[model samples]
Target: MTDILDSTAAGTTRGAVSSLFPATIGRFEAPEDRALIDGLSRWVEQHFREQLGQRPSCHVYVETLPAEIVALIDRLRDSPVIRELIVRQVPAGSGFEPMKHTDELYISHYNKDRGGDQGLFDRHYDGNLRFLSSSMVVRALIYLQSDASYKVVFGDSRVEKAFTTYDFGLLDFHRELHWVEGNYTPGGPQRILLKCNYLVTAPGAGARGRFALAANTAVFYVVKAAMEYSKSPRTPAQKAVGHLCNLFRRLNIVHPLVPLAAIAASAIGVAVLAYVVVTP
Candidate 1:
């Protein structure tokens, strides 16, 4: 593993122009553990089978992860490469403190043919509060299955190459605009990826930052629900409204207005719902 990190295979980018073009930190192949990879693949398949009725896509949080998965996460967290990348982002003299919370760790499985989740394919940042905070939060994705449809694009870069199994990469969570194309055949392959977020916080985030984070989180859930609702079969009126919301989302790819547009669309939805309910 040390040799791998020191090799020319590792790469990092800095000073991105905007949120659309995020600074990539590193890309490296994780230590080969065929048994562990196979085990996790089976585990994820079974979990979705039992819990999600073999849905096209789903994610499982780290809290419910098996012991082996947890152990693997610990290993990744302690890796020298990941540690160095994280330390570089820390504010000077602010101190480095590792967070143990698992809220931002999860494993996602996506099958294009099974109607993948919009959230997974959407062109959006990683987290709800990502744009609101100055705290450096990095997103790491480790691939379990390789697929060409899973793409990451930066400024002027045409769909970065697909990641192979055991290939893991780290990028700025707040700045990267990742999305997938709508190219799904009837029986395409499933892609399973483990995702983790590493946060390096300044000592005093202050009350405003906390409030902004909470508010953004709430809005995110509401917008998520709206997106899910739009996907289902709906009446003509509902379909029209859904289209409008989708438009807002597409336009949100431009930074600074991403959250604002989402907020406006969500607020419109709430107001309409309120009027409908009270107009009896």
Candidate 2:
């Protein structure tokens, strides 16, 4: 202790950046229920599992956030600290928007055999995956089942390209977290980590400036996506709306199974015509 104090007194301070980028991974004790804004996450995860049956769809992944956390986010979005982090402006053609990070991200394993559609699957849903060229995604994950189990690696662009296959090991890390710190860009910034809960803090990673910033950025995108996916359509007229949504598919407008409910008016029209002809 005295030696450490002496070093501090000598002004041998440490760096505030790690090889990691925007943010770092950590775990804080969530509230008892673990349900809140994440109601959407559960819904989205389950829906994908049911429809895709564990196919390797880039669209399927899971993030589980509990409620007391929601309050934390609501508070941060309005906080001045976050105000400093957001980009107020960018080039018009950048196809990007600045966002604020005010919430903790959830990273839960989503094995179709393990947790395809649990009870909370059917609920409000609102979220989307962030991707570049529709091929890659910036992802964050944590293993609740174990602590200090394994690390999530983010290599330099050269390293990532050289590697073609990776072991999809079971996420058994507890109190430990995993995250990636690269975008679709080449060698932009790479600092990902697999660490204990203590290592996941903004300041902790920020202290070393490794994965913290990237992790922070990824969390922001996840929150925004979730908010968008959970909103429900406000009417029973979803049939018309659903058709409108599928317009780009160019499926036959009305095939044998368009559903009686969907064309109730048309059904009524046909019935009236038949009745009049028979009476005549």
TM-scores vs. true structure, each candidate: 0.63, 0.23
- What candidate 1 gets wrong by more than 4 Å, as runs, is 1-21, 25-35, 50-55, 66-68, 94-122, 127-133, 156-159, 185-189, 202-245, 255-280
Clashes of each: 0, 35
Q: Give candidate 2 regions above 4 Å deviation.
A: 1-23, 60-150, 154-280
Q: Candidate 2, TM-score vs. the true structure?
A: 0.23
lDDT of each: 0.51, 0.26
Model 2 over residues 1-280: C-alpha lDDT tens digits? 0001122122222332121223222332344212422343344345444533322212221123345534543442333222222111111111111222332332222212211111012111111111111111122222222222223342222121111111112111111122322223222211111111111221222232233335445644553343223223234353334333233112212331233244576679899999999995
| Candidate 1 residue-wise lDDT, 1-280, digit = tens | 0111221332343232122323443544444454566566677667655643444344455657767777866665556666566545444322233333432333334433212244446665544444554354556676655566555554333335466666666665555666655454335555667666555434454554345444544654565455445543246665655665555556555654765767788899999999999998
Model 2: number of clashes? 35
Top of the candidates by TM-score: 1
Q: Model 1 — TM-score against the truth?
A: 0.63
Look at candidate 1 and give me any clashing residue pairs.
Answer: none
